[model samples]
Target: MEKVINETDDKIKQYNVCVSYFDTLQECSFSCCFPVNVKPPVIVSADILKFPRTEYICGENFALDGIEAKVCFSDNEFLLYNYGENEGLFSSDVTTLNKTGNNEVEIKIRNKYNNDGFKYILTVIVKENRLVSIDIGKNNEGDVYFRLGKQYTDKVFFDHFSVTKHFEYNKGMTHDIKNNVVFNFEKLQYLGNGSFTGVLYARYTENEKTYYGEYVCDASGNNRIILLTPLPVSLTTEKAESVNISNLAQKLKSANITYKVRYQDNTELTFTGDVFNNNTYSCNGVTYTINCNKNSIWLDWKADKMDCKETSLEAGKLYIEDFWYYGEEDLIKSVDFKNEKTLIFESENIIPEDLSSYFSATVEYITGCKITINGNQLNKSIDKENKLITVSYNGLKFQHSFSYSYSSNGD
Candidate 1:
């Protein structure tokens, strides 16, 4: 004998059967089935953060920290809840997006059963910000301090990184509200001119970005000189023994501009060509010149860009005044001064012996202490008996005798 039961809709039914006992029953068997319904895992909320889009200031990079997540979207399939993201996963780990305005991303999580789950799509906005200014300063002891921002922090600040100077401006600087540190100038001050190449240095701070204006200036003592943006071009070789114009043309062919190079003279060559399709120009510098002839190519470099003719300056043995630099330091290249005739040395007490001693003490001192040096305007004379080194330039005369002095600093 066997009993069977089933339930549905809050109702039950039962039946009993005998095996091989009834006239029509030969054998019997039984089976049962049940139903169950389980819901899916729950998703709390999706967090989205909007980062500040701006340029990097002197000491400021894009803010890699400080992200506030907001519940913007969630999954529609499940009973959604609100739970903050895992602390370690969200903090200090922001995606460095490209220079675009909008970014979209997807995240995944797991439920108590470890079942894979997903949430609604999240969107992030990224903006374009480029570097505007870099300011370096020093305190009393020459410790460097730099702050980057779109607004100026203080006034009367001193810069000691390279040269320390007191700074003042007519109109205060401005900062972009939308971008925390995009500096917009209000009033620029005009600083005095530089001796070498006439490049001016101006000092000002707007927003958080510090401005050490170079190259130009305004009337209110603000520097107006803008820096040159770096070029995409680079020298292919360490030492360019020779330059092939045809090869250069093939290498750098963009738009209608092509580069051509040729040697003209041993010391002075001329080049008439274009690099980026600007104009056919000529250059006279230390290395070589690229001059284009009517029918052929010509590259030339002057042999004596810093050569002075042989002459004697002896004004009654008081020393011949031929050429003179204001200071005892070496000549500086590319400085435009109010007066080139007047030589000015920043350090008044510097002497030739001290300069030579410093050079000997430091192994790599050649690149330090940059000054405008021009040997072309100088006249040199040698006294065989006294072993004297005499030089005359710009109506000034200098003479010195060498004495062998050995120091423990060098062999």
Candidate 2:
């Protein structure tokens, strides 16, 4: 057995030669005991890999922030010749699977002395990087619908089944807008003087329940500039209205103020005609009742007529109201007042007066907020039930003024 090497040592060819008796070239056979390469290169993590054939790679998904695999080879003399993600990529000794799931890595090793080489398959599982942001794409109408859009930077992230968390529209069920999103009831209510300055109520699915936030929208050429609350909120949607404008109406002296909606062309539509009777108001030639979901602005219009026990049987009427909501998202529709005896409550306002001896008030909020009453806490009691707070010896029933702000993360 004889073995010879070429200059490059990359070619393996066999030739047969014999000296014929007639001085002509003829075929002859030769034998040799040449060493045959028997085994492939061994890798410590190779057993964890899938296919060992031409399709030598398989992968799974990971969501953890930091995870890495350590690969050790059988021999140190073998060269870590070339390793990369693709054909034209540069080779590096250390391969990284750090991105959100779009992954491929190649680890190629070869014998330093011969033409024998091996390609190792590396299955990288990087977590999918998910993105959540407020999106205001146009609706079926030319007007834009505010919605929350989830974007995936890499397609491999989806292929690896990295999307585990399912999304819900709003935990509070404020709207029917799909994809865990919220939108304005009006088309272009965000547009103001020179820019847009209005609040938007938005919901997304990172947590199980509905959430609320207020975003101030500004128009920039063709795009909207908005700021969302970074913290989380759990303000419960109150079944009964969370606002009591019966006392707030005292500030307005129960005035009959007209509510009007102005359009882009300076055209105005009136919502309230006669403040005493709230049947339905006409706007833009369309008639509507007081509703938060519709074009008619919802208000803190609260009026209650209680039977007062004075020297004579007289009616104690508290007729106080105003139109405080510009759009659906700007109103406070509900709140959770299960606990806290001193739970400060405020309403998103606009009210009408009813001289009847019955108590009825409704408050709805679109944005997330907390209500604070100034000094009028409920202290007056009727038998065991409280009616109003008594001020002086005269027993005057007057609720103090109130203000409101956004809710904190856990409040």
17-130 per-residue lDDT for model 1 (tens digits): 434333336555445434333333344564445433333322222342343344322334332222233333332223455545555534343332224344434455554344
In order, the Cα lDDT scores of the candidates are 0.30, 0.30
lDDT of 2 at 277: 37
Which residue runs does candidate 1 get wrong by more than 4 Å? Answer: 1-85, 88-94, 112-115, 139-318, 321-411
Tens digit per residue, CA lDDT, model 2, 176-197: 2345444331233443212222
Q: Quote the lDDT for 288 in model 2.
A: 33
